[model samples]
Target: MLPSGTFVLGGAASGKSAWAESFCESSDLTLNYLATGQARDAEMDQRIKIHKDRRNDRWQTIEAPFDLAPALAALDGDSIVLIDCATMWLSNHMLAETDLAAAQDDLLLALQSCAAKWVMVSNEVGHGVVPDNALARQFRDAQGRLNIALAAHADLAVLVTAGLPLTLKGTLP
Candidate 1:
């Protein structure tokens, strides 16, 4: 059985992904990488390639940028899921002009029903300045709200800063 669920949050390039990976590697359960990022630009494509290269062949990589609920539902209980970053997922949804409320509902519902060990990644966006556009503002607000909700439900909520993981909600065993 899965030990528990966690949310690994951080700013850009804060080593959240690496730390979360280490946490998962330390476990004996089967690993599944649920990638939330998409190759939209040359830079993102390179980044995605780098991440893919870093992961071992033992892990099954699933690219689900928007509707992760379905992916989570399809997962077996014995596997561990690592959602690279919620920032990208939210960006994908916002770029598609998706229904934020319904999307969030689906996302949370997926998490609730997931049986495997899940380590979700999210960016800490509220510490930044206000956006100039309405859509940007809406995205920032939604990200903050979504992070808060996810953190509250997570068994372990950690903030990664300067490559350091700080426990904010739960203890690391």
Candidate 2:
């Protein structure tokens, strides 16, 4: 069977995206990198460049910072989609004051309708000190909820720590 949906969760700089990329490379399908990050600052721009440089030219990159669900829905079934990641996409919606519940529902619906194999990367944000500010706490909660939901929906789920993969749900394909 084609890799249906795989979720990769990890803390910051935990190499989850790199793992997901390599996982996609295991398949022979057309590779599609759906980037949800925006170059909002110099540091982020440099980080994005590093990520871009890591991928081979065979990956067709799609910038979907604000339109992840729609972009995902538009992909062909024969493609292997790597959404690296969902955290930034969530942040974008939160910053825009969008209805996150509704947005998440839409994203899940889009995923249900999608035919391509999916590898989704997201930050595991709940394993740290509590934020002092209300906005930060809210973001943390939302991210946690989103992560749980995605994990439940995924055919396979893996947690990355210290650059090691630990399968949480189904076996790695």
Best-matching candidate per lDDT? 2
lDDT of 2 by residue, 5-48 (tens): 99999999999999899889888899999999988999999999
Candidate 1 colliding pairs, count = 0
How well does candidate 1 match the true structure in TM-score terms?
0.94
lDDT of 1 by residue, 8-51 (tens): 99998888888888888877878889998888789999988888
Runs of candidate 1 exceeding 4 Å displacement: 1-3
User: Which regions in candidate 2 have their CA more than 4 angstroms from the true location?
Assistant: none
lDDT of candidate model 2 versus the reference: 0.89
64 in model 1: Cα distance from truth in Å? 0.7
TM-score for each of the candidates = 0.94, 0.97
